[model samples]
Target: MSVIKVAIVGANGKVGRLLVSQLKNNNSFSTPLAIVRTQDQFNYFKNEAGVDASLTDIENSSVSEIAEAIKGYDAVVFSAGAGGKAVERIFTVDLDGCCKVVEACEKVGIKRFIVVSALKAEDREFWCNIKGLREYYIAKKAADREVRDSKLGYTILQPGSLELNKGTGLLQPLNKIEEKASNNYSINREDVASFIVQSLLHPDATVKKTISLVNGDEPIEKFIQSL
Candidate 1:
């Protein structure tokens, strides 16, 4: 029951904030470090959320600088994204930012890495028909590939459309997920955060795996064990 030390990139984002709160309350981990872009964000996480915070902008930092930010943590979670505000960010934040973090992990010898990726990112045909998302999907696909090719032990959690609903603590089996149309694949952000916690706790089940997540009847632990 040794406590794990975790650092979360994009700590100011929705999923990142939930993860920081969950980790602080869970005995399995230390107060997770929240890596943020601004002094204001750093202050919010440190003061309001009661966690350690580091001011590190993933979009602008070099691999070495990012490595320095996350230096001593046992695990690193990459949940940062461009949020679709700009097309250029699709390349910089989603694709290149992910690569930089993977390289940073390698530079520092950190093995455990978890990435929040998009559902169906690997299937080009699936996203090709969707308007306005081609670039985003492309970035996600490349980022997922970068994580796979890296030496770091990685778990890529490709959850469906992120919703702000409450956590159900359940997930549809990955095999059954594809049976439905892509439109039905949405999951709550809270559930995604919970799954992230479970993934961190049970690295034996999650490391080096890419899992598809959506709300369902089976408990998170059961779904994890079934893996």
Candidate 2:
């Protein structure tokens, strides 16, 4: 139960920002390392957010370089993504970027890895028909597979449509959710961030598991116990 030093790869994103704040405020964790792609982001996380910041672009940096940046951290979280309609970026940032992070973690001997992936990415039939999102899901599926196949203790969180609502600190396992037919699965980004914290805190229960997330009535702590 020592203080865990965490390095978050996408600290500038919505959920990533929330994670940085939560981890920083928690006594169980040391200052979280924010790995960002630009100097502006680096400054924000370092001078403003008061956390260690690394200017490393996952899409451009070599695996060796990334390993160097993340070395000595107890865990690494891969939440970076190419957020937009740029199809080419989906391959570079979403796919190759994730693979490189996995390689970097392995090289550095960092075993605790968490990934933020899309819901239903495992079911190709479900995402393939969704217009404009097939490539993103394809990248996510491949990235998820790489993590599962790696030697690290990995947890892949697949959350449904992300929303901006306040986090209720509550969740429901995908399989237990009864409104699957409605196809309106979604969760707040803050809730997803909370779940990541819970996963990191309870690796024994979450390691090697890919859990689907959606906002519900169950508290995060209790929901994690059920995992």
Candidate 3:
């Protein structure tokens, strides 16, 4: 038996780093692959984060430029985020870029797909809702719609407020809330990464399912599998 190969898009982000760490030690996976941004990121991510393996880099590359680099993976995680860029840029990456990657995945016959998305993307006043933030959410939702209908095995994770935290593996999926609800929750980026990886390995995983996540004290794997 061979360890499964996985690819991580936006492999330099917060959750991306944690994804790399989790994959390196997992028995079922090879060192998860990364589609990185710049030359600087290639070194920093590998050296600082310990993602060494047959990893490839598409530095400052567009989504279209990613196909050859990610050609032979079992799964691709879309963790590419806007990083406070212009609204237009956010649309370009979060929405259009994601679609392009999915197209590439189809072209190369890659079957498993996982997406990192925001929890309340459909709301008008989502927290941390800055000028272009709503646009970001809209774009992610549009891409999510595409994946659900694309006939591929896909999992879309819409996690609640993202916050700075040291890694903790405990995870809890959030209950779907109405758009006008006043409650809130935050998830550690590491836990978010773990959920994405687990979804990739499980064939019976939540395919065609879009789930929301929040920090919980329960074991992360059980919490997700029960969903």
Per-residue lDDT for 13 in model 2?
93
Write the residue-wise lDDT of candidate 1 on 105-212 in tens digits: 999989999999999899999898889999999999999999999999999999888899888898889878965456569899999999999998898999999999
Worst 10 contiguous positions by lDDT, candidate 3: 52-61
Candidate 3's residue-wise lDDT over 1-227, tens digit each?
Answer: 78988888888888887788788889999877767767778777677766643233332354455777778888888888778687777777888778877887887888888889888655546644565466777887788887777757888888877766865777654543343134356777877877777787765867778887777667777776677
TM-score, per-candidate, Cα-based: 0.97, 0.97, 0.84
Q: Give the Cα RMSD of candidate 2.
A: 1.1
Give the candidates in order of lDDT, highest first.
1, 2, 3
Off by over 4 Å in 1: 179-183
Please give, for residues 41-91, the per-residue lDDT of candidate 2 as tens digits.
Answer: 999998999999999999899999999999999999999999975899999
Q: What TM-score does structure 3 among the candidates reach?
A: 0.84
For candidate 2, what is the TM-score? 0.97
Question: All models: lDDT?
Answer: 0.92, 0.91, 0.74
